[model samples]
Target: MARAPWEGDFPDVFVNCKWKSPDAKIICLADHGLYDAAKGQRDMDAALGLLDDIVLEKTVSKLRGLERQYGVKPKLIAPAAQVSESNNALAIGYANWLGHELGWPVDENIFQMKDFSKDKLNGWVRIAHRSTFYGEIDKKTPYVIVDDVITLGGTLADLRSFILGKGGRVIGMSTIASRDGNDVRIRLDTDTQAKLEKSYGSDLAKFCHELLGFDHRGFTDPEADRVLSCSGYVDLRKKIVRGRNEGDASRSKKQAAR
Candidate 1:
């Protein structure tokens, strides 16, 4: 889809203003379906930064194997995002342990400025609630991203964009688990892009630009699929707009109560 007319020559605030193809390799330990028996236990623990011994061991082992397979010895490890409810993030703990095991330093510079926890959000609501990153980055450092889980992969994508924009190089991303068949890569594929354009035309692009400060190309593969699953542009737009409005109202109520 072409760029919206009003989006000329502007930089995206949360991500890299210039679009680039995804190149980082994804290394996930297990599928989210593995926790089906336990239901919300895994997601709850992950959000609260509670790491089980088995989960930790498995994650580190898988990451080590993937590191060898990829033949990439990253200089630094950066964990993606943070939980609003707690200072300790599961990814941060994972990064620290991985750094010690691999003899690399863990970088804790990037910070998430918002709470966009997927567990509490409804369908396509997350599209309007992208997390923003802030903090210093060391230029030219080869960094690997670590996270507790991946769904739409928007958090990792935003983190990658922030690092790349700040001149750091991201070589790989690792997560403890992800939804089955969810590709953790951030860039939307050409085939999917074509489908979206065909279905929604430039209106989709315009809506994305308005909501996300970027176009549909910034969407992760699963996120693009989620949008495509909608009946039409009207339905998609309504979902996004209503979700955003509800989120704002909820946050406002919380603030007022506080």
Candidate 2:
């Protein structure tokens, strides 16, 4: 598991923005080309780096529509934190292009403040080792988040939380692509929350606070669903604990190699 040089070597810091109501609108231009490519014989390298001018144009076009629909002009565009397998900040390229095309300034201040990588991890492991961000945000400005793709939306949720925590308002998010049937909304619904509480009882909140560094309400819809899918709270705890141990060992090995 290679880590980015810029990724910090510290504890994970989870931010609970309590994002609810008026779900943040997402403008996804296409389905994730990479995943689609993996299913058959297709090349998606250019798409991954936002090097395809057609895709870029399409993304910008949709963003324009979003602007008109929302009637809010974003002062800045910030890319969600994502370090690729080759140690590249993938979303930054897309964000820069979007900013240039949309006449918005690109904000690169928010970034990963931990040495965690999401590549090839299962859902539970990914949730256990969620990325943390650190930086200054312009509190007075309305912002838009940009990312190459949306999976479970944990990354974008964290980015939104960081901006909201810094007193900045994120008007919306624009992604190049998204998984089919995936909802962009991050807030867990009442029904889902009720189910989670029923399964885990009050221990759910304590578990989230102690392990993930947030209250249970901080969970995104997908994250809460994943948690609820566990057989029981003990099973969930064991999985998280094992994931954390594995992560710690990997980081330790990397440090020793350095």
Candidate 3:
């Protein structure tokens, strides 16, 4: 609930990005669990698995346990990811599970990661584990970007650059859980804004949620403690992203046919 960069007059989920649009499109969803990332350890999952930890990958399992015990499913039951895998795999895994649970087709695509050319910027830009990608983002394909957990959202920023850079737009974004803390400023880049004007002829954020529903879960203080009580911490952000690069390869296939 930090003060957003673009607060008034923006549609449902639009905001501003200092680097890009005066009006950017920003959306948010929460991570499914919580973990204390090890200091000096860039590896989120591995760090959590070390000695002196408690693991709580069964947030959903506990909910399921409660549901079976009580005989009814909660309307918004979000589960924690049990393993640290690639981002694509994590997303597909979640989508597959959701499909099984909801009985629908769920597909996902991740942004490609590319190192910025030294020619493009001054000194080393603070590239998160996730970096901006160069590629095409298209649709009629049903997919959402997924991550195990969302924090400062370096990945989301990378995604925004990729999707907009390719004359495409974000349908929606999904995640397992979040740190429950962020100060993101959302806005549409020039490319995304132009695409919005061409495709919808109106505001993009107003219709995004209607087209692709937000799938996410919030961490309660108790649930947070329960999760942190365990030693299995998994930041799988980069690894999860590495998994999705394969899916994005097909973009060239589609573009070739175009």
Residue 47 CA displacement from its true place in model 2, Å: 6.6
lDDT of each: 0.59, 0.58, 0.32
> Which residue pairs show backbone clashes in model 1?
none
What digit string (tens of lDDT, one per residue) describes model 3 on residues 7-91? 1221211111121222324222211122223212233443233211221234324334434544433222111122332222333
Worst 10 residues of 1 by lDDT: 11-20
Q: Model 1 off-target regions past 4 Å? A: 1-52, 55-72, 75-88, 115-118, 181-186
The sequence of per-residue lDDT tens digits that candidate 2 reaches over residues 1-258 is 111111121112111111122333422333333433321222335334333432445446656765686676675444444333124433565566667667777887777654545555666666777666777888876777766556666676677777777777766666545454222555566677789899888887777878887767767667788888789978888988887777777667766766
What TM-score, to 2 decimals, does candidate 2 have?
A: 0.70
lDDT of 1 by residue, 1-258 (tens): 121221122211111011111322322233222233222332444533333422445445555654576566665444444444434345566566567767777787777764434556675666667666788887855777776566676677777777777777666666645554232545566777889899888787677887668888777767889888999867887888887887777667756766
- Residue 128 CA displacement from its true place in model 3, Å: 5.8
Q: For every model shown, what is its TM-score relative to the native structure?
A: 0.69, 0.70, 0.32
* TM-score ranking of the models: 2, 1, 3
What ranges in model 2 sit over 4 Å off? 1-62, 69-71, 75-86, 181-183
lDDT for 73 in candidate 2 is 61
Model 3 is weakest, by summed lDDT over 10 consecutive residues, at 212-221
